[model samples]
Target chain A: MPVLYASLLTLFLILIPGIGIGLFNMKALFGIVVLYGAFLIFISGVIYRVIIWAKSPVPFSIPTVCGQAKSLPWIRQNKIESPHTSWGVIKRMLLEVLFFRSLLRNEKGRLKTGGRLLFYRNLLLWFGGVLFHWSLFIIIIRHLRLFLEPVPSFVEFIYGLDGLFELFTPPLLITDLLILLGIIYLFFRRLFDPQTRYISISTDYFPLMLIFAIVITGLLIRHVQKVDIMGIKAFLIGLFSFNPSLPKESNTIFYIHLFLVATLLSYLPFSKLIHMAGVFFSPTRNLKNSSRMERHINPWDYPVLVHTYEEWEDEFRAAMKDVGLPVEKEN
Target chain B: MVYDKGKVITGLVVFLIILLSPLWYNALSGKVEPSLKLSMPKEEKSCIEERMFMRSNHMDLLIKWRDDAVRKGIRTYKGLDGKVYRISLTGTCLSCHIDKAGFCDRCHGYSGVKTPKCWDCHNIPKEEGSKV
Candidate 1:
């Protein structure tokens, strides 16, 4: 019930901006103010989150170790899993960030009818996650052509590579299909799995639905509804260079796509989407597992007033003497 | 399990400031909104395409013109309005839009878009009454 309401709310949020820009011809407002504002929020939000994470003092080396720690020279150590040095930490972080090594190792627990609990590798989730992230990255890079003039050769190279399949007039990009497939798989996984559905919140489903909408609208513009590419480039170039201009005959689908993108940008920092930045500041990933070799003290630890035994003795001296108790000094 | 109130507040404050920087900066500086510097063509009331279509899709038309003229040895285009035009940048486009600086450079310069490679193989026309 909460999920349905949240999904509808998210849909409404995207639809309003999209319809406003598309139908009302509010391209100038959506293109310039909304887009730039979203970018500002994304940048500032990421920086703020990182700063907060950095300021928090980790009083313990709490790296989540999945393998053997570095010890005796003869014994094998998993440097990538149980990092003991900064370099090892960097290597581990690269693998985790780039390949999602941890997620790749994820296992789904299932109880058999005979009362036996078994764990099986869940490769579908890992594949979907990797596919979605990588495709999104490539798509973003490909979009650089719109923002930049005389589009860079590398961008052209990537664009060519993406459309190498060449199934149509404007050749189909493999990443586009992969991203769509990945998002669908993830969305279904959340909806179908009882355990996942039980733990899932509105925030979790909203982004998926939002991204799905974005991609669908984008595909509509590219294939079905053919927008003015020159106009889009001109508008985007003007927007970035601070001299924004709305092109004549703006396509509704293009505006819809742009509005959704803007919404995603603005909502990223406040939502769990900030895991993109949070991953770098995570203690479990960033910290080295060297607590056995070195001690970590809390920097914020302060001295407190303590009632010493000597002070207690002094305060009770008279009473002790009256009672004729044995004393160290005749105070 | 102690929460750092100071860190949290500072983070929120920084986030707000950064997010609102563009608005505040623009307001304080009193910067005027920028406009594209599109110049009117001399001796031509209309282009090969509709005015609105030309504004947004001139590049596509130009690219098609270039490819047709160079690769297919076709130099004429039958426009949407049923008017045929010779596909030559220097011969057709620059002939009307004589002042490249005032006409082409206007929006391109304002938007920081790079000039097309049309000039690589052709001579740039001099301004009227100016010796090359």
Candidate 2:
């Protein structure tokens, strides 16, 4: 039901821009205004979330360590597994952000007929996640061509590597296929996998469907229903340059693509998709496992009124003597 | 109320740099608004297909021509105007847009696309009349 609702919502989003541009003819509203607003929202929203995380004091060095702690110099320390220093934490974070090191722990154990336990990783989730993320990154880098007027030599180099196979005439990028495949795997898993499905909600399905719609619309603009890209590029140049205008050849599919992407951008900060920024702020992942080595102190510690045990005994001694009760001090 | 102001600011600055990289690059290199002007053949009133269709689907059409002429030995294409023309890149296509550098490579460069393998097999068309 969540999947169905999410799909229907995505369908509606796809139509809104298409019809807004195609039928209603509100190009400026959808293209320039809405998109610019979304960009602003995304920038502020991410910063806001990150600042909030920054303010939330991590009162404990509660890092999740998987290996032996550092003790005797004779014994080898698992620096990566249980980072005790800043450098170790940095390396751990790099591995975590780049390779999804933590997600590797996503495994299941099964008992075989021979009474032996087999523990295998849920490889599809990890693989699909990496593929989808990396593909999306490459695709975004590729889109820098539109925003950047004189596309840098490096971007061109990436373009060449992406289209290394030269599948189509203009050179189809493998990332398009990769992202689609990855998202499909992820989506199917969410819908069908018992554990994932039990936890899956509309939020989970929405992003996947929205991303699917974005990619499909982009593909539509490029391949199936081809629009004059030159005009679109010109329009984008104006957009980036602060000299905004709609192109003569501005097509509906393009508006739809832009709408979906901007929608994702705006939705990102508020949605679960904000794990893009949240991962860096995760205390468990980012914290150093040096609790034993160093004294932990709250940075925001403030002066407070306190009644010490001695002070309490001092105040109560006279009363206790009057009542013949036990007192710490005698006068 | 933010703690670790240095790291948070660094992260935000990095994000901003990447976000505005396009604008920064453009500012450094100057905006490349290459108004691509393809010199139409003098005598022809219109191309085999309309201009917009040619602009968008030229690659599609070119590939179709390559497959038809080389693979299937089908050499003639009936235009939308009902005129039959040779399905040839060099002979039919390049004969009109003779300045491959100007007519083809200009937009391709603007779009950050390489001059694809269409020129790998076929000769880079003569640039004598190129006005780009």
Candidate 3:
């Protein structure tokens, strides 16, 4: 089932761009409309999934506790892991969201002396994960130049900072390289690691592969194919303005890049990637662990007629007497 | 114990508020700018005057084309000397025109093209005497 789901997702992800490119390359109005319709479906699906997950039954308080649970006053607690207070939870959530701290804590199994197996703290996965995510975020922010009017100064600053490590011709974007490298490392490790591969379904590999394809296609368009950036911007602006005019000389490579982006957008909500939104709605991350501190009566529980212990005992006294059962009043 | 209607009501109300407040704000804050009158060059003035006749979409298109010219780094924007102008046709027009039909399906709206992703960079209804 996991393999099927992942395969279907990967197929959709890959085909969406293929279809978008086919349509966009044709420059047909119907094609563009279809693209928009596809986008609508994608957006709707994402929201639906999020809402359903948000409404899912979290019947128990099963937070992955790693900290001291606000117990004895003198006990020292791991504030950042097993958070007991709202502030602590927030701190924990920040680390989880920004750093993937839990994943960072993952230990790699190592074979030691005399064939004794041991687990050692692995920082590479954590570093790769963080590098990929932050770099991807920076790249996205930098690209906001193409989308926003007056392009926020922060975006420009980031763009400049990203270009700081450029040592080659045309000024290489370091974040781009980092993200590419990170994706590559992650992909190979997933494939090469024996334990990971043993448990890994095709679904796990699909997203990584899809991302790799996207990065490659993007790089090709930027560096090799050399699509006219201005023309592309014009196209985007034109798309944003409700006037879709193609320049007489349009580059096919630009269409490929756009197709991939559009595909990613439409696919985002349906896939594991929707975790972006899921992270916010997560009861674990968002909800305060105030169960012990404050009463959390189930909001869904219905009101019912109360029967006190005394009343119950009185009702059951005759039956208890017949059964020779002891009671407060020995009938 | 069964369901609590009061709690459900509270949750629903909170959910509605969270979802609708931003949408309400978005709708309330949107202000469509007034369309501009086209100030044409002397040779093309009469021709454009007959065509536009106070219609703003035409002016909007003209401004779009001019901005497109500037964005292409075209030297066509007058009074800039010894500057490199990269004159080119671009997809800016298509971005907004393509999205118009679905976006403006109401009010008997009619546009020659469909795009909605354009207004990000250039000002719509381009102002007269503004630098390209």
Candidate 4:
């Protein structure tokens, strides 16, 4: 099902740009408005989906356990994974979200000499995944510099930091290259690993392909395609001011890039990519393990009337007598 | 064994069909131009041929400073018209790169910067070819 959805989604993403470009170029105001309206729906839908998930009820405490549960005072406990209190949960969530501590700690076990099991940290996978996510995040934040009028001080700061190692002649972006490499490794792993390959569907391939498309298109526009930067800035400025005028002297790759990006935006909520927001509302990550200390009554449970044991015995007196069984009360 | 073989053959054919269709389409479509037109009026485009053109950059910086002045309206600049233009400088890059996704990508794609979904907020102009 995910494969089918992803395939259709990929096709939609690929097609929308062409259609939107066609509509936009033709000065079809209705088409542009409708397409943009659809875009707005997807963006808002993502937010709504996230909020609904945030407000939804969890019937169980199913946090993935890596450390000890918060229990007896005499025994040491791992507060991060199986947190008992809000603070502990927050700490655990921070580590999980910020550093991917759980993913970092993941290990693959293999049989060793003398039939002993050997657990080895999957550092390469962990590092690759971590690098991909962190760099992706930094890239996202850094790219925000392009949207704002007066680039935020923090954005400039990050840009400065990223460009700190000007090792390459033109100065290479470590995070950018790191993110691209990391995603490539992940894609390769999924394609090559038997386990990942078995479970993988077209959706898995779609994001990778789309993201690679976005990245390559962007790189080409910047370093190779050599677009009219000034004109682009003019158009960006106009858009920020809510007066979007087509920039003069723009490149075609830019259109391709924009089209791919719009597709990603329109598809985010429906895809597993929602995990970015899902982390915050995840019951396992956010919910406290208070079941041991306090009884959690499911809000959905309702009161029901049933016969008491005494009443049941009275009602079934004739049957009980025939069976020669004891009753709750002598009826 | 026959059934398994049939399924395998079916999957291969599907994969080949999926891969070939795009190749066929591209072959038939010729070179797909950007959705937007590239040519501008000669006066506007004269800068394209100039290697050491500073007017665009100068204008960019001037407009940027002008924007800052306007936002930080307390400051004032003497414009070519001789009237004082507001010189507000509360800097925020989002001020200009509003539709980073839409507008910047037009050029950045050529420049090779990874484009993001920055357009959800800022609207991109319809490409000339695809313009409305």
Q: Considering every candidate listed, which one attains the maximal lDDT?
A: 2
Once superposed on the true structure, which residue ranges of model 4 sit more than 4 Å away at CA? A1-39, A51-56, A111-118, A167-170, A313-331, B1-132
> Which of candidates 1 and 4 reaches a greater TM-score?
1
Residue A54 displacement in candidate 2 (angstroms): 1.6
Model 4, A1-331: lDDT tens per residue?
5446655775676566555564455323222344355457565766566556645666666666767777889989766667888788888888888888777777778889899999988877888888888887787766654544344567667866786775432245678788889878988888777777899988787887788777777777655555555455445444434455555643456666766776676777788887766776676677777678877666556789988877877889989989998766665
- Tens-place lDDT digits, model 3, residues A1-331: 4446655775665555456555555654323554566566665776577557656656555566756676678998667766777778778878888889888778878899999999999898988898889988887777755543334567667876776754432246788889988988887787788787788777577777667667776676555555444344445444445565653324454554555566666777777788876775566675555568776655456889999988988999999988988888764
Docking class of 1: incorrect
Q: Which lDDT tens digits does candidate 4 get at residues B7-97?
A: 3345345634542332343345443222333333233323221422322232334444655655665455555446564443222223333
Error of 3 at A257 (Å): 1.4
Model 1: per-residue Cα lDDT at residue A57: 84
How big is the positional error of residue B84 in model 2, measured in Å on the Cα after superposition?
3.2
Best-fitting candidate, measured by DockQ? 2
Model 2 ranges with Cα > 4 A deviation: A111-119, A304-331, B37-45, B127-132
What's the CA error at residue B28 for candidate 4, in Å? 51
Q: Give each prediction's root-mean-square deviation over alpha carbons.
A: 7.2, 3.2, 11.5, 17.2
Every candidate's DockQ is 0.08, 0.65, 0.03, 0.02
- Model 2 chain B — which ten-residue stretch has the worst lDDT? B123-132
- C-alpha positional error of residue B15 in candidate 1 after TM-score superposition, expressed in Å: 15
- In CAPRI terms, where does candidate 4 land? incorrect
Give per-residue lDDT, candidate 2, residue A163: 89
Q: Which of 2 and 4 is the better model by DockQ? A: 2
lDDT of 4 at A196: 79
